[model samples]
Target chain A: MSEITPEEHTQDTRPAKHSGERYFGWTSHPKAGLYTFIFVGVLAVGLALADFFVHRHEYIHLAEFKIFYALFGFAAFGGVVLSGWPLRKLLGRPENYYEPEEETDNG
Target chain B: MGDTLMSLLSHTNPGFIVILAGMLAYVIRGEIPRAVVTIGGPLLGLAALVLHSALSEPLATLNMMDMTFVLYQVERVSIVFGLAFLIAATVNSIFALHNKDPLQDSMALIYAGAAIAATFAGDLITVFVFWELTAVSSVFLILKSGTPEAYKASMRYLGIQILSGVLLLMGATFIMGEYGTLEFDAFISEGEGLSLQDDPGAIFLFVALGIKAAFPLLHNWLQDSYSKATHTGAVVLSAFTTKLAVYALWRFFPGEDSLIWIGAIMTVFPVFFAVIENDLRKVLAYSLNNQVGFMVCAIGIGTPLALNGAAAHAFAHIIYKGLLFMSMGAVMYRVGTTKATELGGLYRTMPFTAIFCIIGAASISAFPLFSGFVAKSLTMSAVGYEHMTIIWMMLLFASAGVLEHSGIKIPFFAFFAHDSGKRPKEAPFNMLLAMGIASFFCIWIGFPFLGGTEFLYGLLPYRDEAMVYLEQSLWTTDHVLTQMQLLVFAALAFIVLNRVKLYPPEKRGVVLDFDWVYRRPLYHALVWTGAVWSKAGPAMTGAALRLSRRVYNRIEATFSPQGELSRGPLSAGMAIWTSIVLAIVMVLALIVGPH
Candidate 1:
């Protein structure tokens, strides 16, 4: 068995060389570029909503548009609920919840 | 002439072909080519589909208590499901080609055949028989993993499945007693003008269907068992049980009001769980729950268009979901695991696998021009037609949620997201081939003029309305834009969340879910039951026996002729003399009264 075996359930799991931060495949990314993406995504959504209203039908209900606000609010609420309570527990370390125990001899 | 004709006629039964082939394969294990065994199932299914009407249900009775269970019915919905099961069997057998477990291979065929037979069953009895067969046949795949966990999971799976069949039998018994027949055609409670909810056995039937459908809290068995099975076992598990539940739902409760809300919740809750789930297979199981939610909602809608959507979604889901499972199975094969946190950077070598996984992910996420696109849109549109604003938005949100996990997280983590520096080899040829066919169907069904949509519609409960909706307003800019916006913002959310590092970092901890309550607490309860049952059993029985013995001894001592009562005969004689005097007095009084 590999070194990282959990003792109770006897199944072999592939060992991780360095788990604390395997860099999680971020070796190629510039960390600052992500901030650019966040900014651009927000700007793009805002611009698109504005364009849809102003260009599509020429109808105006900007003051009475509570529906869209409610929708976004619920979406945010759901996203938080999902990530806060369950995400950590649900997505766990690796598939080997059980690993083989080391061999021992009494006889 | 009679002998020749009879020999020609006996080949019409599909059951014979399948069981015969299974026997033949086992006998000719080393002699005959493997392709013959591999090709045997679909060919037999096709031949059966063609000649079933000419032949009778074999070794099965349609004649029990005036209830004839027709083993083969060419109904539209059954046709769709049966066909899907057949195709899935072929695909699955291919995926398992490089694999050599005789138990898994044989059990898979038997399970597939049983599911098909269940689809064609004409009576509740036939359905029950095949239903049990499916449960029994399927556990081989799980047990073949040879892990203690696999054994436990298979036992749980088989237990739940058989329990479901028992409930079905109980309902069928009640149904048969009330109606005097087990034939599965439409029934209106014998003579009632309207089959009211208060009808004697309707609730029992509904509960039975609800369990199989994985309604809300009853859903965790799926997440638990599917996660623990062999890679190929999980794939085979997808095609049968829940869809069979769907077939029964369509048969029994087409337009029930409660199913609508139940179906809506079924679609929604799993999204949260899917988002947080660790094992990719389990995540897909939750996603599968959410998709089944759509079908259940359609079943609730019970409109022709909605029913079509339900059937079509089940059809499309089986393919794409199986595709996802197959790809993940391949990942599990190469890396020896499929937990998202453990799997990454496999894209370096398994590009084709990555691509196929992405196609499955996209199809399931219901991206425009995917099979899920054409099928799921019908159900959502049906909700809109009903003016159910809240359910509509929830389903729309769910579609986005689907994309985040199934579309992005699955392939992204397993293949690309963060390379774990594990340079695993590519998937075996058969696994890739299986994924490819499933992926092809995802496109073929979604693309225009592919006859996939038409073929699907042809097999729906309500065909005409769904076809018209598909023909009209399907491509309108408003509809497309709305769908695109929901998906685009969802995609944007995933990207933004990832960029800002707000997305939950893949963690290595057990996430408690509804299953935790059952898996742990209920497990404890069973242990307690066993403890209590064993602890109390002897004392309870001993106390009852001792009390009975004491009562019997007292009766024997007091009333026996040779005992205390016989010795007291003198006292009894004195009492008799007193009674004689009283009798004389009463007689004298009666004489005086007459005078």
Candidate 2:
């Protein structure tokens, strides 16, 4: 095999340039994430505020509290996301973990 | 002649027509003809279902082995499921039109047909036959992936599925023994199913359905096989199997007390695994498990509204879940893999697919004016009515979890996350058409005043309860607002977590699940045992032979005539003693034998 030059190797390892037509180019803008966060934050605050004005009837007693669903939703989602750190450590394995032996046997 | 044909068509089990189409598709080499047969089959099946003259009566029956098998029977619940399945089949055929593999095409229709057959089956034996057929036929979808891993996964899937079928047969045997009939109508009366406490067979049936339903510990086969199936195969596979199990459970074991907690756990635990999962398809599989959990829990509640929720949710879920799979399948079609780490910036090229994927995501997240909201409302309300506060809380948490994995992660990572800078082509026209149809249903069945919701509600087992919910509780201001709060806040949480850099990055690896118990430890234990036995087995056998030979020699040495016994002559005292012993033995034998 021919030795790959330093420049060629670097190029090979670098992410490829996107060559297709850009359908949602705005998504790639630097401020897109900031915009999305702001939009969702506003929506969440609006919904929580609306809960106070609306005479909300609920079957469960605890849900009658202001923003209970909102708090629960936030905590549940955050808890699940944060738990991923430890869960990955506990359960994650190499991509080839299950297949190495089968490959060897087949070979 | 036309009247006769109509009568015959109405009498036909729609599944048989689809199976015939599958058989026809196999030999027809031309693409157009094969597509015609494949797509036309489900259409015909739908027609057959619609033309049936009466409900809850056997349209077709077969007598064999001194028993009658109701091959084609339609209940309201069956109609809803069967309708959804037929719709799924048609859409799936369209989605797979670009694929040229006859084996996959034929097997898919057969699998779909078997599921439909089992759905409409009025007897347990009939259900068992089609149940095994579904397992046998659908394994080809996974094998079609043409990878060693896929092959192995397919084998595991088949083994587990066949085990389920075997358990079902055992339960049927027990039912026959106890009830003297396998007919569902004989045991399950109006508004009630077989009680697990009263019936010994119900437990076996429960476990069997549990395995198929992907109940928590028994769930790995779904993720294992589904993620390995061919792209089109996954879309087809998503539509039928678990939903069929849900239907069976609703038919046989509604009001099961254990199912509520089982379903609650199912909904919760997959959230963690899915959060860390890198394979996008497997994430969808976990999401599927969570969604099915809602149906299972509702079935446990067994209220009219709850049952309606289960049926409506199954119908909507089949469409939306299949749509999601189709979207991912489209991604897989162009990108060759659905690993989150490798997929991004895809929306730049695949805008239509991205839009469809978003629709599927929104539908699954139970966003207002989507199918999930309408379908899930009944279940949530039913649990609330029953005063199951803990169960309701768990379901609420799981709903947020669903948003994290399926609603946001799926679309966000695949289409809009950090660009991997890889550009891929848009999906084929057929795939887009299928997704478009599914997306339309998601909106149609969800949007108010569209008549889709009304039509779906009309098909519920308890139509009055469903209609009442639709009119009063479903669209009430508080209900919609609370649901919106849950989803919007969950999404806000996602954004906040991402901003804080707490969201886990997609990594290239496998997440161990319950399958690890079998795939790693149990597998290694068997291997270790085999290796030990290979070495120690012969040595132990040789030792055993040596000891036995020594014992035989000792006995021979004492008994041999020429060596010891013949070396000495008999004495008079020995002869007298022998005679006395003989006389005593004769006396004992005479007394005992006569008595």
Candidate 3:
């Protein structure tokens, strides 16, 4: 069976370029909270990097526990992504897994 | 003699609740019996608990032919679990008032009573008897759905559950053979957590309890049956079975090192499944697995602090999870679907129920002001203090995952996701009320200033830290902000992913897990085995029978009356008398040996 391509995931073909909800009771913020989030994200990532370098005794090497976690993280992320494929159908049930049929249960 | 009779009348056992429930099932037309059993049976249990606990003397031991076992033990942990169970049974009964199915109500009560009875059991043998009672009573709730799948799933569920019970008995029997006593306290060996070295029967019992607790790969029966049970059935099932296993673990396998890793894995594996799962109930089943994982990990930690954490988490989870189930049950009652894809915009109508669902979500997510926040922090701190960095990180990861699946996805998808345009009516008043009470627990337990939080901490394994933890660090601004940061970022990820069309939408097919091995392939394997058995096993036996008959016919012709063994009175009488004497000897030996 054919799978939906990632290219088709985005729906960018709108007549108007719409802005999100109004910010600070003035104008719509097309990029509101975007930079703030990015800044926080970068700082967090940088901190993680700094910790890895700073704590070389703990970080330069893969701890036994980290191996399990890295493995799990990859496995879980892959499971989610691959689930979108027809592979999911192998286990998926119809929405009516337990529904009583109208005619059968009806008096 | 009069006092003895009075004691016996009020005491709890496997027989009274089930037989009474069976009678109640026979009499009540619909909701009344369920209401009575759900609400009234617990009060009966509390009275029984009082009777047993207050008996002044130690619980009377009973010796039945071969096995010697205590009728009850009123220890502190057992008391807490029993009280929690009593409360759960009552709450469950209330939550189930909207259910019109009597069989569900009856079976639920029997199930609850079995759990309580098992908790009070002071010996392995007594626990085993009531343990299987739990299995037998619960299968009906799954079967009560009256669908073919429910029938099939419940049968598989019953088979696995009964197998676990038999395993427990096998372990108990072995323990008795080794120790010459059936009391639970006398189990001589404790495995090194998951190791096979420390005890023979302990590992078997651990695996059996692990099966009930939904540990890792052995946990398929939960998702298999919980996903298929009736709306009320799911709630009833959630409260006891797994928690009982956690209790068993605490009692028997505390300090076994293997549990730590196993519990960590248990906590993590279900999040991905919960995130992608389409069935709302199944998602909760995964979430339930995740919650149980926390308890299992704590039990594995095996410190008093950790054990208390496990007990506390089980207590808090039963209510909030039931509340979650109640809210979902309301939705299912009104609209007849628990699929996330088919549900949305329900808050506008079922506002009260929706609010309850949100409360459940928040409590489970360990939001700073919920029951989960308090109970869960103990385990996290325990692991941290022990310097198990990996476990600590895994738990933190799981906390974020919990936020994604339970805290956000549950309420977000079911109540506030893209509108499905189905304007179902508000859930029944009783259902909403059940949700309301559950929500109250989530709040009451979370507020540290409130004595409820302090009281829970007081009951911890490390009571010395109870006051200290509450005052100093439990609600530190830095800690709260860090937790919020993690949870909020995870929520942000889910939102961004959803908005960008990257979040996995609820799909129309089953996600294969360990259950797929059993439900689809093994189920079909068993069917194939049945076909093979019908075709091959009996036919082979039949052919052998025919060949034996032919040989016997030839011999009979030579003997003129019968086969060689039956030929003469001299031989026959001797054989018969010998067999008779042997049977008598065995019977007399058993009768004369014990008691």
Candidate 4:
């Protein structure tokens, strides 16, 4: 009887790349990522300051605070991300914890 | 002649045509015919909707069990939902064209048709029938995956869906008993929502719709089943079931005050779940629940603007959410897994799918020039107009949450994060075409007054109310700036968190939800009970048998014929003496009585 070996997984199944195939490849470059992050951060700060010039009609009393939208967005997102750590510890189970097998739903 | 032709078409149920197409698709073996039936069916249904809308009222009424069932109801509210269903069906068919499974193809059409049918159904009985039909047909999509997990998940999905249908029927029966009519017009006042105060049945009806809408605790079925379905199946599933229930809620339980808080909870909880969820499809499912929450809240408000918001949100949600699901499905199709931990930097290969996914994410997150902004503005404004400060704030928080989980996380982890060392094929052409069409709608609906027409706002149930909001403008400088600030700041938070290594890493695991109460501990409990029963049953049976045998021996020894009296000659002599004495006493008594 023959036995299957685990080393076979090292073989690549992807198609060979050709010129002009990688449309968004630059996104992965470290320099490009840093520049992109800086650009987005500046844009966010610019928008947050622009809120003062734009006379927004108040809906809630909290909206009166300067940079409220920005702060709220930051806090809301931060809360979700930070809280997820505790949530994962409380709730996370192995992928196969619900059943014995993984990737069972093959066509 | 036109009038006569229109009347003939009006008599036809659009859903029936879609069902016929499904039947034809099932019978046909060839690919072209199947695709034609799949795509063409929804187009024909859309045509039928146009014809039905020409008629001013319900047509094709059926009499059964001494009650009137309005099989076709064409009204302003129903038309929007029906149209959305048709569009979703067409797009879903196109998305599913590459797959050759007839069972899934047919079931998808049938499920979409059933949802369309339920939307146009004027009576509770008609709605109930089509509601269950949607459940029965859609389960096949999950089952068609042909894996044990798919099978189990589909069963669970079917069980919850059927339970919802049963509750709906129970509610409808109560309504029928009280009102003596099953026609929707009788129970729900026109323009006013179903009043629980007037009819207790409305409560049950509300709960039924809540379950189908994946409200809060009852929502685990959506994540569990949808994440397990086939790629095409997930896309198709995203379109109809929950949205149909939203439509039903709008029609029947609008203005039910409790839905406000309920919807608020629905919107917020899923964001946390999505944040921790590993399966990309499951994340989308959680996102779907959150989006539906916005609509449900709008429906609960039940004002004209709010209702319009609900209707428009449903319309936009179907496309954008479907696009999101389609993109994930493509990923799953090409790579065979949608787990966030297992996928990254696929934008290097499947750039088109990645782009479409980003568009879907932006639209769902309500970017300034996206479809979600136009549609969601109405609801938020409605909430503000009503001075529901807390809910308005929660919705704001949820909007940020949406940006975190759906807008950024989906595209970032799948496309731009640390590259996993796997490259797969680009998505097939048909999937691209489907995504393109949905993406076009997302943009087209976002910029109002495009192409010399009011795009999405015109199709809303309360057109005038929506137009008022549209006139006030979704693109106000303040509004756009504020939204941009919020969204951009949220992105910055992600970037900062990542730089600081404060972001939670994606891991392969299941997170506990309300479903854990049943799927885990309850299941284990039942197994334990069965084990104890199997072990203890024989011993108890043997003990009972031994006791019964001992009782039998005692009875035989004391009272049987061979035991004492009849076994000895002395016993025979005693019996004879007793008989002689009795005979003498009788003779002496007789002689004395005569004297």
Candidate 5:
């Protein structure tokens, strides 16, 4: 609802003032980044702890290992993200890879 | 009055009300009136569905072409899909409320209506009619973008959709020919519903649904068309077409073993494409394909619990996927693009959209308390119970992949990544309302405390089986712990990768998909053929002319009156020889006749 234009907004790459600032104020703060990391790490570990407390009747044999899901989740996600590098190398064409000349026209 | 109302409702096709509202919307000019009709149509259709839900049998049948067409079947399977379709229609209408285009509004309604209609269809002929209607009506969503690219993409989308419809009809024909009926009921074997064995017709039907479902290589149409659609059009487009195919597959090919491998491939490949995809809408399209794979695999498992899982997942998926698309649509509406390479720091200006997108992402990623967890658990457990070790592993891999592409990448890149310095307005109030509603359901359905799991379970076709599984397995400490472990660790992986700067940066480019075969090489090949023909045509024509002239000259020399027989002395000698031969023959004939 604010009447501010893109031009009028401050050029600071940090947080732009909005209601989002009310909730996500710390995201822009460099020191708070560590807190965010810690929060996630603690949550991941706590869930892993549940592995010891909760006995899972799993279908896959590998799933019975301690924190198996945790390790698998971490590895699978990392693999997908890291695989992007190679995939891009193989599949990445210039911006106009599909329609080479059209990008310039649109741009 | 009550009796009369009940009787009237019995004959009414719930889907027709929505379609009629669409038709009515075309005639209205005012934004408020059109919005009312657009939103109200689905609401009324939802009401019709509620009114008709008590009737388990076909509420009414049409005698057309000497065959009975069930216009309104309100069985458990149809009810689940029907309800989901109605909810999606209502939500999408709200998302698209800001757009004043009557064409987009009407087409969206018609598209949704056709899907709902097809859902309630008890016979193949009825399914075919609505199936093609969905194809024809939905293309305008892409076309309404009014871009040349969108126009071309719409044509491609339309072509594939119509091809699916054609194949479906062909399958129906074969089924009818073999079974002496086109009723969808023909496939039920003693008690198992619609099992596809070695039937040739079922294979055709499977391929048709696969095309719509974007089964791996057949998936290019979804990304191509959806990414190019008008902002609202994309939101509306996301809800119906592919999910309809999923419903159809659930109906027809449940328990077919081939679906297991096909579904596994579906879940894995899209994750990679989505990772590298530049268009946010296109990424969601890939994510949609991946999610459908889970449902498909469950259907392949064909157990009661798995089938219930597929149905529940479809119901939930329609809402979440639509929400994700709406969020991206809002971004495109405000900023004129959803390319991740060009978008960042949008949460500064578009906080609500960002939040909704995250909710959608979490739901799709199967966060422990989201809608996906409740729905997907049934399938995963069914897989485990069946001892399909390898397929289960592939599904596990896909689970992590979903978190990577749809769950994390979407929000991280578009809203919170490196600031691209693009400040856009928050989405309109109507779009926010739609997203808000969808996000609420995303959380509501999966939270065990919210009773959504029970409500959704009650709607399953195999209700007793689902409830038994629910009682035994749904909220076990082990299941919840494992799910949380899987999802949280995936999040941990993303954070670590981001900290290490190992995540691939989004860039502008078209990654080649199967569409490249048709859109690029096949098109270019045709163009090349045309060019070759153009270049070589005249020379070949001239050579043919020269050869004909030589043949004409030879013919003239050999048989033409003026060229040889009439003008040359050889003709006179030949005539004299012919006369001598004839005279001798005549003499021999006279002697023989006398003898």
Candidate 6:
């Protein structure tokens, strides 16, 4: 096994000199995000439509309503993700927040 | 002689054999020999577990200090957790094949062995022994990172773990005092465990297990240590400690009521923390907390189906979570950090790791046809059966939360988000093989008719309940469609959020957690107290010394013979008065004293 020094580890993050090789380049295309969003939107709509046709035998009464899970999932996930903005503002610290400064100062 | 040897092997605790192999690995010189012992030990333990004679009975016992210690007992629950541990140990050894650190190899095996041993222990004393051993042995993995940060984190980790072990010992002592024996069979019966309210020891045991299980507020050691451990060390560390706690919880406090709320809170709180976290491994640490919450909740429900759910989820979680950690470990191996801000577009080079990571993400997210879906269904149904609507809703909300951080964020930011232009090489072959094996189990157990679910369900404590659940509810149209609806909408929400710029971008920072209360305020308080003592201690001591000296000088001036009494020669009047006083004292003594 080869040992990776800290210097080498930092250096590895830089773009490789031999940059010709590429795999899964399509994922980097300009419109990939748009395409992904459209695909997921279509799937969500389709699933919602399927919910009306399928009978849900639910233990909780509110879940029997059509597209309840769809709404709940979308709202719950979005709520959690959007909460990140305030969570970060409230809790975020510098990358070196926890590092002991005395050691570095003495050295 | 052959028959005797076989009998010894059959009756011996598989963990001891694995521990012996670990000791052998320490002295072994060659790489191949060490690797053989490291990987082969767990395999041999699995064989021993299979060959053990019976369930719910002690296969081996020892008489010590006028007490019988049941050292090796195979129960249905034990087999589920033990098999998973042995498999994980082997997989972890394979994953670490490239790193030839002998100490790590030995300690990893020993840590794993101790957990398995504790799982099979029928008496609390035996459990306490291996419990501390697991804590002592596993700290070496974190120390192998060899960074100041890793050192600090490992010490904190060790402290918390040892505290948990101390609590367990205290609880065991209480049990021994209350009951004449400490054996599970003697005190706790088959289906029912000790009640937290009814027994003093149960509360101690609950808190002890809660700490190890990373119950809500007591969970910082996990995120702190796991993110700092060596890449391979994180993978090994993830497999044992908390799962052992869960096994203990199941053994001792299956139906405790407070665990229901504790587990619910455990599931929801980490999701919020994980969302804003930058380090991908730390995100997974939170995700691990969330996943375990489901099992904890299931155990709290404590019906046959729920217990089965807990066991089945643990078995599946040990594999998929290990796979996730292994994938990240591979990333750390080539890239040196798992922070999301420092990683992206590596899927171009490390495609195999990306695929395996996605599989693991999907499994953890409880996608249809995944191990998590099959395992978690029983718990959900059991909760529903009990009509615990509020708790069920909390779990449902947490399920979507799992999809956000683990299912989407891990793979997205690390592999497919905006290109960071990093082109590190693909993971080593051994790592890929380990991940491949784990991925196989995820799909095999998750998909129907592969005999994987059957095998897993068979190992569950309540096989009948699990089998019934598998047949009646698992693949039902409503269940499948609703799950699909939940997951699809959740994925759609992610897309929508990203499109609308609502999704938070990965940044370089640490998110503050409960650890900050200690790492900041408590730490500063101690430091301040020390500084005050350093400044004031000598002053206080000098003042005390000066006061004592002043008193001594005063005594010498006033009462010493040279200072007062002998300064003047005895006057005649004084001598006459002294004689008169002496005569009066003699007369009083003679009058008052018994003749």
Model 3 agreement with the true structure over B328-378: per-residue lDDT tens digits: 888888889888888876666666677788889989989888999888977
Per TM-score, the best of the predicted structures is 2
Local error of candidate 1 at B592, Å? 31
Report the Cα lDDT for residue B200, model 6. 75
Docking class of 3: incorrect
DockQ of each: 0.09, 0.49, 0.09, 0.49, 0.61, 0.43
User: What digit string (tens of lDDT, one per residue) describes model 5 on residues B425-509?
Assistant: 8999999999999999999898877888889999998899888888998888888888888888998888888888888888888
What candidate 1 gets wrong by more than 4 Å, as runs, is A1-107, B1-28, B31-34, B50-61, B64-66, B186-196, B525-548, B566-595
lDDT of 1 by residue, B302-412 (tens): 777777788889899989999999999998888888888898877767778888998999899887778998889888878777777777767766776787778778887
lDDT of 2 by residue, B163-275 (tens): 99999999999999998999888988545888788666888898899999999999999999999999999999999999999999999878888888988888889999999
- Per-residue lDDT over B1-595 for candidate 4, one digit per residue giving the tens place of the 0 to 100 score: 9888777667777888898899889999999989999999999899888876443356878988788889987878788788888988999999999999898889999899899888888899999999999999999999988888899899999999999999999999888888899887776754576787866688789889989999998999999999999999999999999999999889887888888998999899999999999998999999999999999999889899889989888988999999999999999999999999999978877889999999999999999678899889899989988989999999999999999889988988887788887688789999999999999988888865563126677777778877777778566788888888888998899988988999999999898899988887887787678779889978988999999999998888766887666677977898899999999999999989866
Better of 4 and 5 by TM-score: 5
Model 1 root-mean-square deviation:
8.8
Off by over 4 Å in 4: A1-22, A101-107, B1-6, B53-56, B449-453, B536-595
In model 4, the clashing pairs are none
By summed lDDT, the worst window of 10 consecutive residues in model 5 chain B runs over B187-196
Per-model TM values vs. the true structure: 0.82, 0.91, 0.78, 0.88, 0.89, 0.90
Instruction: Supply fnat for every model shown.
Output: 0.08, 0.79, 0.10, 0.73, 0.81, 0.76
Docking class of 4: acceptable
Off by over 4 Å in 2: A1-23, A105-107, B541-595
Report the number of clashing residue pairs per model.
13, 0, 6, 0, 0, 0
lDDT string, candidate 6, B485-566, tens digits:
8999999989888888889999899999999998888877877897899899999999999999999998898667666644
How high is the lDDT of residue A103 in model 6?
Answer: 43
User: Model 1 has how many clashing residue pairs?
Assistant: 13
